[model samples]
Target: MSKPVILCVDDERIVLDSLRTQLAAAFGDAYIYEGAEDAEEALDLINDLNEEGISVILIISDWLMPGIRGDELLIQIHKNYPNVIKILLTGQADEVAIDRAQKQANLHRCLSKPWSEAHLLETIKSGLSKL
Candidate 1:
């Protein structure tokens, strides 16, 4: 079977590239890393992966995007894949959105933009440990 996937969604390509790089560096070949430039693309990618029998293990998304915000996208994902760990990597998400994600999506953590690599890794480790 293929390794589980970790999806990162951000409108900015640079941000997505950086996140993918960081994750790949930390986790190596243990998981598949994917990126989407928007919520629609992320959703499509998730569906495609699901069809391939590759489960998505985690999602890291930015809150301020062109289309759907992180919280809404996460909430939508939660309905179908509650087991997928959710983390919001946003610099401008409001408390209401974060709280909603926490309640509705079981959000694992919310980290500010320009996030510290160490903290991001630690958060992912702790979040995965719960599984």
Candidate 2:
């Protein structure tokens, strides 16, 4: 079987690179890492990966991106792929949005932007532990 995937979505290429780099370093070859610049692209990627028989185990998305906001995106993803863990990484999401995602998306965690590598890894490990 293909390795499970961890997807990171952000409008900034630099942020995407940072997330992938840190994930690869911490996870080694244990999971496939994917990136999407926006919610529409993320959904398409998710569908494509699913069709390929690759499981998307986790998603870490930015809340302030253009197009679909992270909370809404996670809720939509949860409706279709309920078992996939969701994490919102943002510096700008309001409490209402965070709470909505927590309830509707079964969101695993919400980490602030300019995240620390240690905290990010810890969040991932914690989320993965429940799977």
Candidate 3:
């Protein structure tokens, strides 16, 4: 069976690279790390992975993307993949958006941008524990 996936969606290439590096260091080879620059691409990836019988265990997404916002994307994902853990990593998400995600998406956590590695890792570990 294909290994579970940890997907990160961000508009900025640097942020995606950082997340990829950090997640790789933390989880090693146990899970696949995938990155997408936009919500549409991320959704496509999710669909493709699912078609291959690869489950996406977690999603880390940014708030202010070009197309669908982070919360909306998470909400959409939750509709079909409620078991997937969703975390929003944003530098400018408002309270209303966060609240919506929490209520509608079963959001696992919301971390501010410029997030500390320790905190991010801890959140992921805690979320994983719940799964």
- Lowest lDDT 10-mer window, candidate 3? 23-32
Number of clashes recorded per candidate:
0, 0, 0
TM-score of each: 0.98, 0.99, 0.99
- What C-alpha lDDT do the candidate models reach, one value each? 0.96, 0.97, 0.97
Candidate 3 C-alpha lDDT tens digits along 1-131: 78899999999999999999999998899999999999999999999999999999999999999989999999999999999999999999999999999999999999998999999999999999989
CA lDDT, candidate 2, residue 86: 98
Off by over 4 Å in 2: none
Q: Candidate 3: give the clashing pairs.
A: none
Give RMSD to native, each candidate: 0.6, 0.5, 0.5
Which 10 successive residues of model 1 have the least lDDT summed? 122-131
lDDT for model 2:
0.97
**Candidate 2 lDDT over residue span 60-121, tens digit each:** 99999998999999999999999999999999999999999999999999999889999999
Residue 129 accuracy (lDDT) in model 1? 90
Which residues of candidate 3, in runs, are more than 4 Å off? none
How high a TM-score does candidate 3 get?
0.99
Candidate 3, overall lDDT? 0.97
